[model samples]
Target: MDLHMNGGIGEASYASNSGLQRMGIMKTKGVIEQAVSDLCRNNVNFPKTLVMADLGCSSGPNTLLVGSMVINAVTNTSLEMGLKSPEVQINLNDLPTNDFNTIFIALQELQGNTTNGKMRDVHHQPSCYFTELDEVNKGNIYLSSTSPESVSRAYLEQFQKDFLGFLRCRSEELMAGGRMVLTLAGRTTDDPRVEESNRLWGPFALALQDMVFEGLVEEEKFDSFNLPQFTPSPTEIMNLVKMEGSFTIDHLEIFDVNWEAWKIMKNDNDASKMKEADDGVGHGVAKAIRAGIESLVANHFGEAILDDVFMRYGKCITDKRSNKENQSLVSITVSLTRKCDI
Candidate 1:
């Protein structure tokens, strides 16, 4: 199935609710700047034409966040170096279901603006899976501590297959010395039992599980769903690159932050904060999470149950995190330089 974030600028749309994503993009600016600087000074001449791509560029206000940052990086670096800015070709891509229109419309106003010349032209595309689960794993939307060992193994196998294919394609697309940077939510270690990945997906899984119990969503419908997310450790990626032999790791870093820290209400001391905000953490998270997965959930279970489903979901989030102040969200960033075609 083609899965995408809910589109448009409405309250429930990703454009309005993607603050978490914007935060991540903010964190990556330094790394992106460094990459741009390296690309400029390390070369004999600042390459006249530069190619950039955002592989999973989801639509919204933040859709071009990374691309714009890169453009700025190049422009700043060129000015600092007393060199001319290169003509930049940016390729923004996502699933076919993604709302590309949102991005195109935003770029319309900035197309001929005073930033370094930026172009949009993409010439290619690429494409993965998990199936079958034991009775114990039924109705669970993602890997959990209770998930059978085979469940994790299946996910690992699939991710390995998919990621290796990703390396192969990119190796071919990039020049021998060209650079690529990847930042994703992944585990600190190879263990599937790791709590961080579980915490990240926990709320959504819980929301859907409760729906199954309340008969809002059929048990079979819930059972058949699994997010094909495998949180690979840095070592796992390093090993994959070594096996693929197309890229050498230039940089690898891990960052940890409180999960959805932005939405956490400020005060439990007064006891009025949550009440005044009408449960800010829960209500805010429901909107944010729903913005991301509304299309998927509605595609699977029709759109009519949305309001009731989110009401319960908000309560679930409040119940779990009302007291717990911190939940870990791990992000791994890796930089690689293409070395071979395959």
Candidate 2:
């Protein structure tokens, strides 16, 4: 696993919560609430029934924030159905190398926040379990990774196979009538730039190129660089789930999130430090956005014209902030659900 990815667990939390909020995902939290309410209504009389799971749960505000929403959804639905609340098993998952410490800290904060219905008893804690995919059992909620963009064609095929395996494994754990909600960065499958499109990455690549031109990063290392896999497309995801023949799809909607705030922050941080006077390496804010959006320049464009390239892509993504052009962002989220077969 790459450090960029391992470190991205936290970054994913930050970006998801921030980008979603900026992009209006908070508005769709109601969908989960409504779905849970409906699910409970159909199965209320079953006392042993397990309800939901938040898979790929990161340890951060999103973990708690989204978990609270799920709990409230179940609580309200349980009330309407005249049944006891179903146990919500939130699984905070990551590679074995993820910083458990941060996740632990976030979990601790969720310990006694009873207002959201997570802490049911003063003595017993919420039914929160931590598991890697390898150890996951049937009945856990499946949340997908938000960070990492996929590479070119060959990698995408292999990536799909692995993701299918993961989905199949987790689908086996869900109880019948149970619902699993997963979020992924979504783009149209037929887009020619499918290989290069990563909502979280458009900017990072630009910044790296800036550093390379400035002699900060070695040139050879750039060749070996590859982005992580994003959720390919809604069609592709649907096909994968259908192929499983275990879990049935419930809902799938795409939300375009505004990532301008995060983009601004990253640019600000880089610009402040990258000035020639400082010992720190900072690529100018404008240049970073350019590198992220347009890594592959067209023919006949030389490195000498980098500034113009930066400005062009920068304008496409930026919104006016403080009468300056530093803030720029683009992101989208796809929400999907799979029901467990009894």
Candidate 3:
């Protein structure tokens, strides 16, 4: 279902600083190092410095946190190899719709704390640039985007195409053997448990069905309950890479994040536990559902169904624990590098 969230991530209510911090995803240093190392391997004229770009950088917090981690990782790795620290350049790339005010505010906060120990006596501080795709050019060091919206097929296809185009642009801009690291949400090659995929929304849907049976929601409006699957699996990503023949699959791995922390506390059985899974897996769906319900209640059902449905979903998801056999939310991060022709 289509959602109606007035304010998105930038809104104070949706993605607060503290919420993101607590998620333990701010540390992207390891991934960055892997991408760079793969790029520099077997290179004849290795760059003494690196330039990095992060696409869809909603705000500086995400980029700053990732940059700091990358810097630290590079320093540690160089020290272990007994080599001098590498110079670094970082860029924050995002759409014009981004909250530049918050991003600038965050960047200002991180600027003073930047350390450039890699360059000798020459303050090797990393230079940061912010620009949109139209302005970005060739030879950037890195690029990243973690956007989660994949509603329409057209939008999804465009997203895939734009990603490839950006990488091609970055590859040209990069020096010989330069690397670009990208992380995005992905689906599994065969989703080991396909049945459990949609299980997350069972309870919520059932609850809504109950409401529909009670005449709280119209049957025609119920048609908005469509869910689209967009997370491309690691294999699919590899295929895209092969098809494009631009970037190489240097370091490709996928792992799951347990965002079900709050879900287990709410649901206790498989049916109810499914709702917990929905909270994480069907996030977009849940958002759509909530938006649909909110719109209906506000327009037709009155305010009564709002609290009624919300409390039902919340209580079921929060109070019940998973059946111990069900699959919950699993976030996959794919890391790739630019491949050079021999």
Candidate 4:
């Protein structure tokens, strides 16, 4: 997979602008904690040495946060059972392009720091689509109303081919009784091309279009590029899991949170601070997006135009927001247990 988040600890890096993703982690923390707690409590084959893996754990504090939470859950479960805490191991996997230096530093700093509920066990850090729905993505990126039927079918076909591979690979890696808590951007409707189901790809598309108009980006290159991604509906996920036949779903839930809901969830109720943040909401949104996809965009379009592109993207966000249009981020979270070998 040519997939990797923007690296580094700088402002535009994924590490700095990952608050939205961190919010996802926070939103699902309770469910994740409960899943781990159940595994420790109910699994008769629970090992004294525990191994936890966070797949696609891109750089930033959030990676550590996930590790810490899982470790804490295991420790808490053992304590409740009046048993000694298990030897915990963490395996963080990301593309080699991710910023491992940040995680390494965080791990070093977290040693013997049990007060914060972060991971204290230092395990080795390992390094680890959008397709051409572009015409419809004209409004912003992602499938839009005008997307043709053929294009949509192409997307589904590609997802089927790729996701099945993903499932089969993970199935082989996980031990029997291993649990995976997956949270991804998903659509509630089967027809993601509908305007209502578009994820937050708006401003970026506008920026690229503007650049293309100004002769800044080659039309040929832009047209050829596709983000290899698909937002599977709940039914689609169930079918895929059943088709793969390696995991059984223990729980599933769909969540739709307003774009600004995560900010409020921080409980930073200070009006002045919120207003200050609101003032730069455009810039903030742009930076957050740039952090996640700049690498992909840069890879396709080159890095020269990124600053100008995202600057325009920020303005696009402000303009869109001004129209009183709002969008919610929909997440499909599932808890899966690795099925035993027959």
Q: Which candidate is the best by lDDT?
A: 1
The positional error of residue 156 in candidate 2, measured at the CA in angstroms, is 2.1
**Candidate 4 per-residue C-alpha lDDT over 1-342 given as tens digits, one digit per residue, 9 for 90 to 100:** 345777777867777666667667777878888888877877786568877888788877677777777777777888778887777777888766677777787675444433334443544444323334434323334556766676677778777877788788789888888888998788888887865555466566677788899999887766655566678898889999999999999999988655553232222222223323553566777787788878778888888988999999888877877755565568889898889972
Query: How high is the CA lDDT of each candidate model?
Result: 0.72, 0.46, 0.47, 0.71
Off by over 4 Å in 2: 3-25, 47-51, 111-151, 192-200, 261-342
Query: What's the lDDT for residue 322 in model 4?
Result: 70
- Worst 10-residue lDDT window for candidate 4 reads 262-271
Per-candidate clashes come to 0, 16, 18, 11
Q: How should the candidates be ordered by TM-score, best one leading?
A: 1, 4, 2, 3
Q: What ranking emerges by lDDT with the best candidate at the front?
A: 1, 4, 3, 2
lDDT of 4: 0.71
Better of 3 and 4 by lDDT: 4
lDDT by residue for model 3 over 218-254, one digit each (tens)?
6554443333334555665676677777666666655
Q: What would the TM-scores of all predictions be? A: 0.87, 0.63, 0.59, 0.87
Candidate 2 structure quality by residue, lDDT tens digits, 250-270:
667765543332333311212
